[model samples]
Target chain A: MGIIAAIDLGGTAIKGALFDGTGPLTKKNHPTEAKKGYGHVLQNIDQLIQRMADNKGIKVDEIRSVGVGVPAFMAEQGRRVVLAPNLGWSDVDFASDLAEQMQKPVFCNNDANLAALGEHWQGNGKDIENLLMVTIGTGIGSGLILNGELYQGKSGMAVEVGHMVIMAEGSHRCSCGRQGCVEALTAAPAIVREAKKLMDVPTDCLPDVNITEAKQVYQAAASGDKRALQVVEKAAYFLGVALANILNFYELDVIIIGGGVAQAGDILLNPLRRTVARETVFFQRRPTEILPGMLGNDAGVFGAARWAALGEAKKRG
Target chain B: MGIIAAIDLGGTAIKGALFDGTGPLTKKNHPTEAKKGYGHVLQNIDQLIQRMADNKGIKVDEIRSVGVGVPAFMAEQGRRVVLAPNLGWSDVDFASDLAEQMQKPVFCNNDANLAALGEHWQGNGKDIENLLMVTIGTGIGSGLILNGELYQGKSGMAVEVGHMVIMAEGSHRCSCGRQGCVEALTAAPAIVREAKKLMDVPTDCLPDVNITEAKQVYQAAASGDKRALQVVEKAAYFLGVALANILNFYELDVIIIGGGVAQAGDILLNPLRRTVARETVFFQRRPTEILPGMLGNDAGVFGAARWAALGEAKKRG
Candidate 1:
């Protein structure tokens, strides 16, 4: 009956958006200021949603629901955040806290899952029956939209595609304490690490831009550095293997690659697509296409708003 | 509203069962005689159903629906077999042919999915919201029962878990043209291959068995052959990795390990469980349990019968 408020609860920033039943009305980004403590983060989200609703000329209670996409492992249909290392949260009742803050029914889900939902609602994944949304940021994350719905497993932790190991011998170690995981090899940090490692070579191969972040690697590749391109290609190969493994099993309708590293465009995507095709079997039976996510930063908030609407309806029913 | 006939169309044998809505009435196994050609295989299925019906004092037309579980890649929601190398089937309209012969509605799915369905109907998977059943024999196969229903992806081919590579650097090659796949590293053939290589050692550590088959390896392990036990443990480790990967992502209620190799019981399961636990993360969040399949060979037929019951209803609607 009213507008829905959504928040993509990132570690450093919260991407907030307002949505009607149709599409996004407005979006705003605000600092999380997480060091101010848990209550402060909730107040930050509450303030963000309040500001979005204010911009839409709607009261907090007039908003249908407040939905949040947290960077955490959630359970209890996303009412709880089991662990969020960045936020230093463990087994917190996020939904209740947000609900109490806003005095509106709250809904929450994994940030990647919400991103997939966002794309399903307004981006490249619209009307796709089975879709996969892969987010390659500081850490690689993925979400499964199966049979036209988000497929959270029994514990609401399905589609851990980033952690799926593609190489057994590779030395890259993931934050999950595993080696050769997709996250270990393809995450933005991994790219930066690889660039850092390659820059130490006897021969000067890279275009120096003080390679502190993944963005510098893209910049180096933009300058047509062969070694930089090769680093990306190598990461793409491992990512391709992981994607193939996912596609071979999940057999989705399409996959949308999103997040910071994926923004490198054709350099990452062209090779990633080729690798997926090379590793996948029975392509003629069902061809699952790979594409870039269209929504950019707004995807998570859009997904969150949509989840609020759907979850609110489910609750009412 | 009549009795259902189910068939597990195996390469060498067809396991048939009669179900009266509630439980299995009787079961019969017959030679598939696949060498007799495709038509012969269909006829064998027809004759087996006819005999089973005659034994129950009913006409063929009395059956409500016939559901067959085939060991092949399926399309069109299991209406067609894309390929079955052992059965020499390729792009055949299996559902239509079976329906025409039996004079009843027909439903079909991958044999592995049917096994999972059977388990869901009457075994360890009963009432489970999400389940994964893995069959590891000639080649490893798997099925996902998600949200209390069989998850057949977009092309009716999901849960290709066996093809998920565990040891990327491993030398074993799978029939699907992939190296270090779960099938390559942990299938019965892989077990036998490992056993054979180790049997050639100077110490002669094997239990004096010919070791031409996976069963011999199990027998050797049973007779206190340390080499055979080690081979199984190694395979289990890879299987555990694959299982851990599946579990980490899918987060199912339970996992059922079935098929010829899985029958080795504690020797294989104990180590496999240990490995899964070791590789999996956030186990403290949701501890998924893995168990052995309870239905044995009857799982496929039971699953087929259940599919017939559900699919027949869906068709009517």
Candidate 2:
């Protein structure tokens, strides 16, 4: 069986991996360094794949296909990325361009969808037919797996959960030029912003709480910091509201909360679960299991590999 | 070919039809008269079906199968309805019970889902693979058609769009014991409540708005009633927000707004279209057509007949 080359292109890091049918053979990560320009990123990705192949005693050209996952709107059947602020791209054919650079057929999709796919293939949701995987990092991103397939709506813009407004008024503004989006209230920066709002009124917390990061807020909350706990509670509540909406809308089986913010563990999860239960329409039906992503960062790469394999099989057929 | 009996059981009326393969041969309606209890309701339904068959010069026993649609949470593969306050039933196996009364195999599902399926078959959707049919009547009910199949989630409780929270704070109370739900803010009664609240103020239109019913609100709005326009605007905005959330989540091709409330026409639809465009995540993608249903009340019966046909085929397979 031929090898599959997979890459998960992110704002800060580019995760690359090789799959040999059964499982991954080698995996590594490199700084995205997107500021260096598109050509630089492309050459770096090509080099990364070459090195991965060399390490596995195989030539880069021997790979069956290259699958790439990007954190952006993938449209026109993955021919181009509509917009990717991190990569400074808009209406550019990243997929086809990369295919040209590597001289091979390329398979591409949204990173969040790939993460859901990877999770479905071997992570927390292993082989489940219906799932919604949400990644909560600098911004919130999600992907849906429906009827055993990745559900990218008509324009390849399905599962955009972050933009769903929970609080219609008196809510934080989002990057999408909207207010009260789920992402604006719960992403890492929002978590830290909310914590800082209550930093003036100290209650069982550090006297000079220099909590500039979401991780620090989580740390403080874990240690019973009252203000930090409130911040986490608010974020978790909004996330749960959105989840409840999703659950009732599609009735998903599993909802995997991944990315940087989810590492808060039980503190973040407990409040989230409580809110979902309170907000859910199907209290009597089988409740969807809300879990943290098991594959972590490797989720996108695994999904990319699977996507490539499927694409290659389809081409052959 | 044997006849297929189809029924759309509503709160006040039972719509019964007999279909012979291609189209309905005879159709009729009878008052539900649910105040007489479950046994009376069941027997009445039997008579209604028998009359439909008799009008087509066929015996009741000659029917191949019966397909029924109810406005409630259908569960356990449509074996029983968990709750249908309209019919005053709880945990009742409507499918098997109807099967016994009709002396034939029966297929049962949510009325909204069947509406969607019917729309997909011959109504506004018309063979469209991906659609969301929302019926705004006494309560908001919705059913999804994805990839040309009716998408009923696990335990058959999917597309409960009305219960999703749109206004988190200081919103009206919903029947589900929640506040600010899409149903609470935009359903027929909600529209009337909102109009009544505005009636106290003087508008350029009605002297005594006395908008006792949702139909009157539409009529008022149609005549350019400023207060009524405000109510319609508010309802349209919330509905747009919910539809935007749905459009982003599933990426369906068309959205059919049926039931009695959608009769407001362009007054409701124009504002709804404008709001959807404003709130959509995929501004550049092919926009989902938000249109009124074409089949009117017949959408459910057509869907029920289609459901029976498919079910009967599956049984043989």
Candidate 3:
């Protein structure tokens, strides 16, 4: 085994890590400046990889491969990024470009999927055969590990749990132009949106803190603010319902929740667990454990590195 | 290849068939008399298998194995029926009992799962690698075939799509004590229930036909009854949402809808297709085909036989 460079491309920053089979040797980050366009982002990634290799005193040839996790819909063969709304990309062959530039093999996949894979490789889902990792942040993102392998559907678009409809005639609108989706109900933006509605209502139980962001709402709820608690409860309810739906549909061993909103801790987890237990089709018959993802933001980089290693191993075989 | 007996157990009837690799050699049915309890149902199944073997002039020794499909939560190895509400069964070792009685190796699984396997093996899903088969009958039942095999989760209870909650605060109550599950909104019983509600609303748009069954509602809707159309539209919307959710989560090649309500043909399929197309997260990027199941009720028996054959082959290997 040799060093592998892993990069996780995001809207704000690009996270990079150097790994050698066992674990990460070093990790670093650089501003994405996505506003500067895809070419700039690619150049930035190339520079970051070079910097990591130099810092580790490892020649470029010593690195077995490079892995990339991007916030995009990857093609089935992982040859290209089919779509990335935030990156403003479509059908970009990032893998080929990076591989050509670095003069090494490179593998790429959906960022969320990489995170789930990371969790499975070295985080919370290790030793678990089947699991679903859902990251609840600006939007809900999920990665499914079924039968100990990544389960990307026919078009490499499986595990879009956020856009799953939780309400048939729901009022909340998702950015995907759909209503009552899990994302529309439980995403950070949705929580903040609900808090904004509650702030206008005259209530003695309102938190003294000004509600501007989802974190503030969580803070207020943690402090026993009734209005904030209601908002959290509502979001937790929908999240729980969505989770129960997943449990019923997949029957996995564990469900790992990650991202910013999941940081609400017990405020979200307790209620979510309760709702999931209450709403699950047959709780007595089929029980699924729900837990928080252990790898935090580094999950993507770790997963990307592992993906590259696996791809290289497969190629060698 | 030796003859294999496949049995699909329903509340009122037990459908049986004999298969020898190529296709089902013969098919027959017998009264389940489930009201007479588990013993009677078992006897019925035994008698049915004996009758089929006799009709084919095959001795019991010529039958390689037996397969039974039941509406229950099957154990991981398909040894027992853990819980089947309709059959009033819990932790029943139906496979062992039947195998002992018939002196043949027996395999068991959920009826819907078998139907999905059947569809994949010989029905509409033939040659397809990943698919979901949803039977929209009195109660909605679904089976998922992922990566060309049945996807039974941790405890052999995966792919219970019918119990997936589609509404967070929905008024419709499912028999499983959940609110607004796919079954509660789209099952045949639910359609009939919604039609009855519309009939009492005092509208000239209501069809003159008695709204006692789901079939009547579909017929009225087909005949241009406005009230009936509205009910069907609502059910179709919910069904479409549920299907979309499955698509987003599983990312399958196709979704095959079967059973009584699916018989509504274009009245239901047309709207469902449109809704799925419109409400899907990224329609242009990922398109999933939705079609009606071809094997119909016989899908279960066919699948059961195939499952037994596969199990025997695996054992021999």
Candidate 4:
């Protein structure tokens, strides 16, 4: 039972952490420099893990294994990153490459899935046996923990709730070429797109600040800007419908909302909760508790470390 | 283990079967007489089970236990029929009541759930570890078998794919008081409703015979009736969308279509399959096999028998 190292590779940065079962010992971050290509990103991850190990005063040999969570689909039993639109990566043997360079066994999974495991292991969903975590950021992503285990479906593609169509004939188009998907309606980019539409319209209800991001829209809504309030309400309504659908399908113990858009807190959650209550088919019989995720951006790293530790234990068994 | 008895209580009749692990030894059917009240249905079920055992040349004492599948929600760990709109039953302790009268333990669960288990154990889903069975009848109902077990959500309410809203803000109203639910659009009653709407219009394409039943609509469609084809196509489209949503959420290995409407066979399945292929998120990567349920009406009885046998084995353990 040695220390575990974890890396969460995001579009902008690679976050690294060292853990020894109790909790994270040290954390560090390095620029992903994704645009510079996969080689540079791999090197950065290598350095990031080394720095995290050094910061924790641990030897490389003392670290049992490393787990990486990437914003991409993992293939070949998590030895490869098959696709990552954000990082422009495809079919990269990330786990094997990292293992070769770092001299430790490596495992990898979709970042969202790890976030769910992290939440179930030690965060908001610690006591939950089954849970769904939906992250509403640049694009919506979800992870499912079912029957006390992370359910990856038949091909590690389960819980793609974000692409579920809320509006069958919706006007908005998703990046996946689908129309009316939940991501198309309520992701951070969707909210920003809606707010930009409002900005172009002639209205005295416009916010004073330049509304460019989803956060600005939330801030304006909090300050009672009419246009911003309308935009947020629309996104919240769609998000609620999607959540209600998930609740109906999974009947999970709890649902954790995380990522950028969820930071609006009560302003977003209140309306979403109301919609879920109204939209859920048997709400009285199957009430689901919806809450905010506790670990925030660090959930992926914690989950990766936990996954690595679990994998190591399984190997021992 | 002794012989096992299973009863599938439908609105019209109670189907009973006796099994000795290998297969059913005898089968019998009795009028449910549901309109006479829950008491009459229970009495009829008892008589049916007695008849099944007697026909098999076995004494009631030889039967280890009875399992009942009802068109209702099983509550209190498969001991009570929480709700059955067709049977006009609510909160009936079906298991305990039957156990007391029959002098043997009795277990109960939703008929659809049993059908799924039956399919998994002996039918099309025998080889499947994760599967979804959607029964399209007067109303649509669904069952889920996940990780090789029946997945009843927190309170036996998971896989209510019937009430999943396929068309948000849709004009069709479901029996559950929801609009645009898959059941609202694709159930037998819904198809009949749509056909009637077309019949009300003055069109040369109208069927010569009155389309009062879903069967009539299918017959007309098979005979190249234009209006009926439109209605069936519309229902198939929505049903496809709902199935696609289920596939995306669960990433199940296979989907089995059962019940009355599925009797339309390829006329309904061909269009539905095409729509599902088009609507699913990653159909290319995760190809889900869609097929018809093999055991047909016998699935419920087989499922109930299997469930009882499993319960008896667990008790022995």
Best by DockQ: 3
Which tens-of-lDDT digit does each residue in A182-267 have in candidate 1? 88888888888888877654235352546778877876776677778878988888888787887766767889999999889888
Q: Which stretches of candidate 3 lie over 4 Å from their true place?
A: A54-62, A201-209, A281-286, B20-25, B54-62, B200-209, B281-286
Give each model a TM-score.
Answer: 0.89, 0.93, 0.93, 0.92
* Chain A TM-score across all models, in listed order: 0.94, 0.95, 0.95, 0.94
User: What CAPRI-style quality would you assign to candidate 3?
Assistant: medium
Model 1 DockQ vs. reference: 0.46
- DockQ by candidate, in order: 0.46, 0.55, 0.65, 0.52
Per-chain TM-score of chain B, candidate 3? 0.95
Residue pairs with backbone atoms closer than 3 Å in model 2 (clashes): none
| RMSD in angstroms between candidate 3 and the native structure over all alpha carbons | 2.7
Q: Per-residue CA lDDT of candidate 4, range A132-213, in tens?
A: 9988899887788988888776666536778888677678878877678889888988888888877665445452545668
Instruction: List ranges where model 2 is wrong by over 4 Å.
Output: A19-26, A51-59, A62-64, A202-204, A281-284, B53-57, B202-204, B281-284
Question: In candidate 2, what are the lDDT values of residues B1-317, reduced to their tens digit?
Answer: 36888999998999989988778898999999999998888898899988887787787778889999987888876667988978888889889888888788999988988988898988889968889999898898898998899887776774788988877654587898767789998999999998887777666667665677898888888998877888998899889888887777676789999988988888999999998888774433877899999988899999899888888888899
TM-score of 2: 0.93
Error of 2 at A296 (Å): 2.1
- Residues A288-307 of candidate 3 have per-residue lDDT tens digits of 78898899988899889988
Give the backbone clash total of model 2: 0
lDDT string for model 2 (A1-317, tens) is 47889999988888999998788999977788899998888888888898898888998878878999898877865667988877887788888889999998899988988988899988998978889999999988888888888887666764678988877653677887656789988999998888888876555556667777899889888998887889999899889888888777676788898888988888999999898888874443877888999999889999899888877888889
Instruction: Give me the displacement of residue A173 in model 3, in angstroms.
Output: 1.5
Candidate 4 chain A: worst 10 consecutive residues by lDDT?
A201-210
